[model samples]
Target: MIFFEDTVSVVKVAVSLLLALASWLLIRFPAPFRHYLNPRPALTLWVSFIGLRVIPFIIVYLIMDFAPRSDTEFFYKKAIAAFAGKMVYRDFLSYHGPLFGYLISLPLYLWYNAKILIPFMAIVEFAIVWATWRYYQSSRPDALLMAVLYFLLPMPFVAMILSSEEDIWFWGVGLITLAYASRAQGSLWIGIIWGLSMIVIKSMIIVLLVPLFFLVDNKFKYVLGLAIVGIPSIVILYLLMGDAFLMPLQHSGYNMTPNIVSITRPFLSGVYNQISLTRLNTISLCITMALSSWAAIRYRHLGYRQIFPSLYVLTFGIFMLAQPSAPGFYLFMYMIVVLYEMVKIEDRSFNVQLILLNFLIVIEPIIWVIYVGMLNYDDWHTVFSSGVNTADYLIQVVEVGLLLALVWRTFVHLRSLDRAASQSFAASSQRTGSSPVS
Candidate 1:
């Protein structure tokens, strides 16, 4: 009884439905054959994941030289800036820190007339792979799967590699490196390495100390030791960079000015049409921060040391949202958190939190995409005409959602453990014929 157009709709819906079912199967099913799939005894699983990320970039670059329409202008301007040894200013161009522009354009400068971004892209991919691999030496299979999801379904690997944001390498590699260095080595050295991550990209690497403190028992000493090294280094970097350092901050503020200014403007007033449209983005930013804050509070009851990993993810996610460059940058950190929590099955309530968070991840972009894809949709005409496309927005929605879910789940699981301990203490007091200790 379905008409031709209805049949087309059914097919589109069916494909999406099948893909969702497959993802669920992959996540829910046991990896009984994981040992076989991951058969290299010599190399760790993290190493393999790194290879998975890097190899694709090399192959893809060979196949196509075309920069994505979204990133071509960024690539051109940055390349020009680095070679010319001058500042490139755009009131709206704040997706990445100045570090990214300098880093990406350096190779092209050295080559004098060659395409340097591609090789640099390859290096970035390699760094991300290596760091992400290190991130998972002891990481659970579920977490590993979440990482893979970040690479494949949620955000195309190409999108990450080509984007001017070099922090992907810092975050993807730096987080894993910090995890290994802190756990395997001692605090002073780990603190030093973490300081480097901050220098490379401040917001991306600041949270590494949180998980590091938890791994060690001497909480105050470890924190003090890290701060002893980290704080001064940060201040020194700010002093050294001066105007260069301020550039990233200026860029960030300019990007957010429209949204921030919109807050004072009325939503539905005829004069406020421009401001009202921007308000849609502000809601997501606030929600992302609120959820992260809630998770951080729930995670606090876990000993100061135990709270780092959660805090690291929560703080990073919040920073990304507040920075207001674009959805993709925020989603990148979200992907990391989601994967970290998905495989770490230490608590009963984690699954529930994960499912809800994932649903949110999946919903945010779909709304944006549908808005752009359909003429009948309220945002279709506006969003599409601008350089922004619906598909990428959908990707960001899903990626951030997954990562947020991971943090929420981790917080919930830790809270459940705390509750269980409290209950056990109460039961013991009851049996001992003593009043339950207040």
Candidate 2:
């Protein structure tokens, strides 16, 4: 029965990949057929928003069994427990932020069930689609395109809203904050507050804030805004939970043996335990920080809009690499960055590469699902305990390959921009009959 199930899963995956490739070919080639998928701007926007964001949740809820040991169940229980006056840090040892517990608990306040949380998250997904549309100042067709892509995108649908992961909420808040940060007329302070609020919900989201310094006009106001919200929140949390307030930070570092770092155990001499994993993560983090600093300095002149994607990819990519586990769901951020860049860049090769990269990103999680299905277990935790399989190692390799591809493409794009700027400056100097400055 297990072999039969695994074979069926493999067949399904093969068929899906073929269909995806065929669809991409059709979209890229036949000009007339392209118009067939295109609808009126407003109608497309609304349809994509509703169909992608809401309908999938309904479908998943009806189709899949909500596994008892799933992340959603874990969160639901924590939310309920927190709402019942249990201290999240002291009592539950939650690695999640305080605000996350309170936020998830809101759905339980009305009716207690995991299903109820879907709609709450779906609403946030709607906000993300809308904010993204506005952020790009895209045409109705472009807005519809983004909405459709996000909705149909496998990464967001499968890893996030389908599982009711908190990252979906964090992603939405991050998008809204980015939208505000990018606008010339938008308030930096408001963006700062929103960014800080995202951190309060999931401290990992603090990585998203790195780009805001480049995006915002007033650095001082941005710092002030962060301090305004951050200082008080920390003090209050400390007062409420005492030293337990620091538990999330500690919990964040706990090595979940399945991460990129742990996958290297076969190459190393030591046992693959938490302490070793933590040390590996520390080394990864240091490398990431150094590379990120160099990128920031080298690309300092790029506009906020242009540089924002690199900042996101670099920061989040590092976090994922350094963290104990790389949940396929988090790739949704990569999807967002790549999709936005695809729309913005005119280079056909770059766009195609981004499209292919997005496809690979989508495939990773599906592969993970198949691997888990092969385990034939009702409890999700059992699959983790069963140890890393060949499939797990394959997916990690795919992830690293995709990350390198994105980083390479970003650097190439930035260098092209620099070349164009230099050429334009030289031309202007010639026209003015003045030697170009050294």
User: Candidate 2: how many backbone clashes?
Assistant: 0
Which regions in candidate 1 have their CA more than 4 angstroms from the true location?
A: 1-25, 28-35, 41-60, 68-76, 83-100, 109-135, 139-150, 156-158, 161-165, 170-195, 202-244, 253-305, 316-329, 343-407, 417-438
Q: Which pairs clash in the backbone of model 1? A: 46-133, 143-343, 210-308, 211-308, 214-305, 334-403, 361-401, 365-394
Off by over 4 Å in 2: 1-39, 62-69, 85-87, 91-93, 109-111, 137-143, 168-191, 208-221, 253-263, 269-275, 343-388, 420-438
* Candidate 1 root-mean-square deviation in Å: 8.2
Error of 1 at 421 (Å): 7.4
**What TM-score would each prediction reach against the true structure?**
0.57, 0.76
Q: Residues 1-438, candidate 1: write the lDDT tens digits.
A: 121234433433443344344445555553742545445423533454455445544454446554333354566566666566764333223334444555566777565433345456645654564455455646454434554444443233334544433445555544544554436344555555565555444443433445444454455655665677667755664666544444444333223211222222223234444443335445544555555555555554554334554555555655544434344334444445455644443443554344434333433333343433422112444335544343433344444555545545556656775787779888999999898765
| Residue 39 shift from truth in candidate 2, angstroms | 5.0
Candidate 2: minimum summed lDDT over ten consecutive residues — where? Answer: 374-383
**CA error at residue 346 for candidate 1, angstroms:** 13
lDDT of 2 by residue, 250-304 (tens): 6444433224554455553234443554575556656666666566667766655
